[model samples]
Target chain A: MTAVAAFAWSVLQDALHRKVFYAILAFSLLLMLLIPMLPSASVGVQVDLLREAALGLTSIMAFLLAVIMASTIIPGELGRRTLYNTLSRPVRRWQYYLGKFIGIMAVVAIALLVSLVVLLILVGAKFGTFNPGLAKAIFTIFLEAMVLASVAMLASVYLSPLVCILLAGLFYVACHVKGDFLYRAMTDSTNHALLRGLSGFLYYILPNLERMNINETIAHSERVFRVGAGELVLLSAIALVFSAIFIALGAYLFERRDL
Target chain B: MEAVLSVEELHKAYRTRLGGPRRQALSGLSFTVPRNSVVGLLGPNGAGKTTTLKCVMGLVRPDAGKVSLFGRDGDAVEARRRVGFLPEQPYFDLYLTPRKLLHYYGRLSGMGASSARSRISYLLNLVGMEDDADLTMDKFSKGMLQRIGLAQALLAEPELLILDEPSSGLDPLGKLEMRDVLKSLGTGGTTILLSSHQLSEIEEICDRVIIIHRGREVASGRLDELLEEKGDCEVLLAEPAPGATSGLPSSASWAEDSGGKRLTVSREELSAALTALIESGASIAEVRSRRLSLEEFFVRRIGKTGWEVEE
Candidate 1:
């Protein structure tokens, strides 16, 4: 555990210490600071519009950062041959996979918090009140980022970087598509049972992004009441467990790989 | 010494759906590296030198073989704590300086913080890179990278050092220096298995050489034995005074290899003619033998020796 912590810390330092991360943070802050200008453009929509815009920025920022960092972690280590140094040790395959996952998660968490703080400062100045929905959205995006990162890493283990990125991007879109895969699976007659079975399984298995979309949280309270907190928790936990399972599978595949 | 590394009928095959049938990377490859000796794993390209090392290091698994190190099953993670490896194209984080690289490897090798710190310093100086410890790897030359690589391999002061072509990119001087490092490691009771096709380079450092041909051991023994059985002859050619190919004991059956500049004698006549040529007032200008270089041995035995290899 200590060794994993040390490894995780090293990775975290690399992610947070680089110039590019600070640049991204500053860019996110600038975007948040621009929210006040929305009030100048509209008299009544200022509160609703500014809040929705911040949530949208945070969600996109968190997800984009997740994908970008996920795409780089394994490829970057391989590019530098750093994976050899780590794997050549007495460390287990799972430790390396978990360590990298935790490291990336920590970085994403920190990035989310930073962006959240900036959003809060803007919200406080405009409305003089804190929205609980904002916190929920921020934290939910953090979980969503973990899921995306894991799926991306799973693709990375066996697939090429370009292909892994493409696949993970497809997964994100698929997760948001609601009924596309499930509906197609049910309507097909050839292997209809198998397809429907798989699709039915995925209906609850995937993150229902259309439901969790934080944009609706700020726009109207009526939309937020329909969703239960337990569902989101259960779904996020399932996603995290699935991510863990995928990482473990990826580690096994990687352990046997020649590199 | 017991075998520090043991592999019995190790095999690794990859079934790629891309094109042809599944290719076997290793089949029926078996060899034991005795402890505390500098052993050179010599083979032609694709002779499974790297495959064998990977098997020993647990990087590549054989389908039907077992690799035991320090008498422990290869699956034992602690066994790796006692093994150090230098991959053929080793890489490190470009942003990390030599100091950081050593620190990172040292940490992974199970060294404690203080021990890692002191050992890092010791290794940096041991490889003669203490001066450039602060420089990032991106700025390092190939030779420097190799030296640092060597240092990292020794970071844990492992009992077995598996180096894959450690001298490939080294200049003559670098090779000599690396040669000294491996020799000292052998002296210090570290079992070193280095793989390379540079026969001369391997010959210079390793006490015993194992030649694997087409994924099987073709020859294994001391260098002298391998060269000796090839039936080599050494000649002490004496310079007979100008125009005196005639000072020759006419009884000596010899052919002038390069228009009388040098005389070539068959293997049996080397001793007898060494005495006669000197007694005939000819001063031996050079006394050298054609000890089979590793390259020549590989070509003769593996490449064209026509040995009925089962592999």
Candidate 2:
């Protein structure tokens, strides 16, 4: 556990030194601050618009931070020969893998927290009302980012960062679309049998990432259906199970890999 | 003597590319580093020296055979806890200060915070980087980085220190300092296995050597014993007498240096060469069996042909 914490702390230190980390973070905050400029349908929907846009920007910030950090950390360390120093220590491969994953999430979580605070201030200052409900949407965004980061990290073990990012992007799109597009493709009679079979297989295997997206509902004050603690627990469970599978597979491959 | 590390019939092959032909890096290569011995791992380019070290360090998995450290499996975390390694041209995050970097490694090695702080300070001074310990390594020279690398390797005061090209990137003085440090460590009972192309460095610091050619052990033994086995003799003369070579055995060769004119002869021609030198009025100052230098021994064992092949 000490070794794991050391590795995790090292990753955070490494990230803190990189310029890209700050750039992504600053850019996300700057954009979120500009959410008031976006046109809205009416004066009544203006607050909802601000919350929705800010949360949307926050999700992008979280995902970008998560995937980019995950994709680059392993490959960067390996290319720089720094992994030789770390892994040569008396630590297990799983510890290094898990530590790095946790570090990436930490960075993403930090970014999300900053965005939440900024959005909260913006809501209070503009509408003269406290909207702590934004925290709930930020939590779900964090869970989705967790899944994205794990997938990217798994790909990063064997693929280059660019390829890992692209693959994760494709995964995000496919998983998000699967809940609707894949289900329809599986049942649409116009599609070929093989296509339907493939869609059905993918639908069953891929996590429903869109289920974690509640920005619109939360931004509009959750009037239609309240997101209770039970629902949040279920989302957390889904993200953990999927992330665990990818992380386990990555660590197994990394254990057998030659540094 | 107890062996701190032993490898047996280790084999490793790396694919050049996906589905490409595998290049053999190690083929049934085996050796052992006895406790408290400074053993040099000498080999030509691409002779699997790095691969062997990587295998022992568990950075690269061997396809066959076993590596044992302290009579236990080399891959065991507990066994590795007692070992420290400096890879060939070790690198680290440039933004980290030498102190911070050592602290991180010390933590990974499971050192207590206070012990690690004291150890880091001692290592920084040992590597002559104490003044620069607080600065980021971004502007450090290659030699400075090498020193930091060595410092990190010694951070835990490990029992077995495995270094690949430990003197690399150091200036002559730095190299000498590194040699002294390693020599002192060996005297203090650290089992070191170092791989280096600098044969002279190995010759000076190592008591034994393992020379590999094309991924197989070509020779291995005590340095003095290996050199003495050639049975060559050298006779030092008191003066540079040009006539010292007159009527000497055909096998005897003469050369003049600052000390005097010397004659080197095979064991069979030693008496005849000495008699010839006496008849020529050459004043003999000393006579002794010749010992081959590490370079000469390496060349003789590996052969010119083995030297020519890059791999």
Among all candidates shown, the one with the greatest DockQ: 2
Clashing pairs in 2: none
Q: In terms of lDDT, which candidate is strongest?
A: 2
Each candidate structure's TM-score, on Cα atoms with residue i matched to residue i, is: 0.86, 0.97
Q: Fraction of the real A/B interface contacts present in each candidate?
A: 0.57, 0.97
DockQ of 1: 0.50
* lDDT (10s digit) by residue, model 2, range B1-311: 89999999998888878877788888889999999999999999989999999999999999998999999999999999999999999999999899998988988999999999999999999999999999999999999999999998898889999999999999999999999999999999999999999999999999999999778898998888987846679999876666876898888887666766678899998899989889998888999888777998998887754432223
**Where does model 2 exceed 4 Å of error?**
B257-259, B304-311
TM-score of 1: 0.86
What TM-score between 0 and 1 does chain B of candidate 1 receive? Answer: 0.82
